[model samples]
Target chain A: MSFPITLTVNGSAREILLDDPRVTLLDLLRERLDLTGSKKGCDRGQCGACTVLVDGRRVNSCLALAVSLDGAEVVTIEGLASGGELHPVQAAFLAHDGFQCGFCTPGQIMSAVGLLREGHAGDDPERVREGMSGNLCRCGAYQGITEAVLAAQGATARREDAA
Target chain B: MNRFEYVRAGSVAEAVAAGAAPGAAYLAAGTNLLDLMKGGLATPATLVDVTRIPGLSAIESLPDGSTRIGALVRNSDLAHDPGFAARYPAVAEALLAGASAQLRNAATTAGNLMQRTRCPYFYDPASACNKREAGAGCAAIGGATRLHAVLGFSASCIAVHPSDLCVPLAALGAEVEIEGPAGSRTVSLTAFHRLPGDAPERDTVLEPGELIVAVRLPPEAAGFAAHARYLKVRERTSYAFALVSAAAMLRLDGGRIAEARLALGGLALKPWRAEAAERLLAGRAPDAAAFREAAEAALEGARPSGEATAFKIELARRIAVRALERALAGTPERVPALPASPFSAPLANPLPSSGAIAHA
Candidate 1:
């Protein structure tokens, strides 16, 4: 059966007429809305390739049923940048070489942003590694990813301290 | 995934009523259920979305010092709650040790308890898995049985309940509160999950349309929180299922164990509570020898299938002992390193079959 869902995505109100209740939030964002920043890796909860912020908490979009979240706020990787400028996490990824093929970049960046907001990414490298363990990098770019998260966390903390 | 109708339940009554329909499944978090649906394993005609049900996500401390955790409480919130950690450290540790941060954020307490096994044979529809298809015959009986159960396993199915939270919940003696069309009822956490007997298809004792509302932990269990530990042994350090996991809680008086509780995961069809081990440890001094005896008591009835899983008997024993030792030491900061298996090491004579080693 078809259902009509209205939700806010990337600060924009989206009114979608969904024909199938099985459509995942990942598919809705990538296919229906044409916001393809979120990548579908395993299409299972095991891989965090489709990580997004649902009400400011990181969750696997591939596992989130779109019909279930009718009025929730969603923030994808595409929403991270504002006014055509890169977010701190994006800048950090660029500065630290966080990706090789960049297929998993969006998910990793979203997870990092969520991690920093959740207060898990501390100054410790081990903490960063554990915090970012969900977003895998087959390119063996963990060292760079960890470095990027740590740097972004420090910059965000400094910016907050100044404020 | 098959086409399904989705209905957002406004109240508990509405949810229960909708879920009472045939081929209707209540959707909470949808982390595990959606994955099963996508894999063509579960195809419910209607999905009753219960996430928006009011007051199902609150975690409240009762007047008796007990805690009532709502069924919709996310795993991450439960793990990070300082009050919950102080009252149930082993539960918190088990939650943190499970899945990943992203998954924990979305996974709910009821959802975690309701998660199905990760048995490869059960996932493959083509395989003869009794748990997935009744009377289909268990393929894991003679197939890759490394991750199968060692205790309370039947010929019908040997799959284990893959929930780290359940081990500690069983040890803590938590109670599950449920609501159905009739009324509300409560069941002991240990009795919630069922052993795979002739009915391998049924995972829990919940009647049709019964919805788990919350889990209540006794106030007395908080006293054992200081001396509790959870240890999970897996192939990888993170994001992997346990080969053998143990949860232990001990109450000591002058270095003598006054009371004890133990539960094991990845070793049985349900959370295997070591009642005999708890009895063995009571009135004994907390030491290596006493722990060893308790461990031996815990694994007394373990029936390993073959060479691949025969090692689990010993592995579970060692992990149980280590968990007890860590509990006594009160060192929750130290994560247990993965124990090396003797079978994994290279052998000098690979073809040796019961060959005696010559003394040099």
Candidate 2:
């Protein structure tokens, strides 16, 4: 049976019309809404390519049912930018050269942004590695990815001070 | 993944009522369940999504001094909670040791406990797995089992319970509060996870329609004195399932072992407690010899599947001993912390000190 779901996405309130009972938020975002920023790599939740923010927390949208998320807020990679300005984490990904194919870049950026906003920054590299361990890059670009996040932290601090 | 009827529950009792219906399952976080559904491993006719239900996601301390962890508490929130990090450091460490920051941010506490094994055969539809199909013979017994269990193996199933939190919680004597059609009943954390005897299909003793509200941990002196370690040895250093992991809590009086609680992960059908090994450490002086003996006693009955993986027993033993030693040493040395990014700096290599080995 088709269920009515009202979800806010990328700072816009969306009233989606879904028919399939098995359709997930990831499917709706990509297929229905054309929010193709979130990749569908390894739909088994083993890969972080489908990560998005549901109620201010990073979730693998492939595993999140659309009907189950009624009246909830969802954030996709497309929403990370404000007035065409990339989020600090997204900018950092570009600065650090965090992607090769860029298939997993969106999810990685989303997860990193969520982590940084939640206050996981520290002087330790191991802590950062552990924090960002969820997103996997097949190109083995972890070294660059880590550097970008650290660099982003510095930039974010500067922005905070400037404001 | 299938055309299952989705029901958003309003209350815990209503959720349990719907769950009691045949082929109905509770959907919390949906990390594991949705993954299994997409993989064609599990197809429930009905899914009772409990996310909208009130009072199932709050983390509060009970009036009895016990900490009540709601079933829907996110893994990230639980790991970062000051009380959990302070009182149950092992639990926090284990949660962090499992998935990456992103997965934990969405994965729920109850979902973590209910996560299935990452066995290739169990995930593949064509492969024979008793857990997936009742009469299907296990392909893992003679096939690829490098990541399979070393302890608590039966002919039927050998896939280990994949939760890192339950191992420490089981060791610390936590109780699970479950409510169902028959009313509420509290099961000891030790008894919550069941060993795969003949029925590998049944992972826990929870009856149908029973929803777990919270996991209550009683305040004990032993729980506070508890020094714990969660050693996750995977193929890669980060974001990988454990090959063989151990969580050990050691209590010391001066320099002698007063009590020890040992639990093994990625090596059993359930979160396994090395009770026999712990019995060997009571009253013994916390030393290298004592640690070796305890490790040996715990791994005495272990039977490995292959020649390459037999070393896991020895590796698990050593890691267990070393982790306990480091946690008990009370060493003030702080390793360089890593940045929150994928690679902010180089990993500092710290060798395990022999003198720091505790009997527990």
Best by DockQ: 2
Model 1 C-alpha lDDT per residue in residues B317-355, reported as the tens digit of each score: 878877786677663542322211111212233222212
Q: Could you say which candidate leads in TM-score?
A: 1
lDDT of 2 by residue, B1-360 (tens): 676888889999789889999999889878888889988888998899888887878778767777889999988788788766677777777787777777787788888777888888899998898888887888888887787777777888777777778887887778889999999999987788777777787778899998888888887623534566566666776677777677777777777777887777777877777788788887888677777787777777887855555877877787667656644653112211321111212113323344222222
Task: Report clashes for each candidate as comma-separated counts.
Answer: 0, 12
TM-scores for all candidates: the values are 0.94, 0.92
For candidate 2, give the docking quality class from DockQ.
medium
Model 2 reproduced share of reference interface contacts: 0.90
List runs of model 1 lying over 4 Å from the truth: B331-360
Question: Cα lDDT of model 1 overall?
Answer: 0.86
Error of 1 at B126 (Å): 1.3
Lowest-sum lDDT 10-residue window in model 2 chain B: B338-347
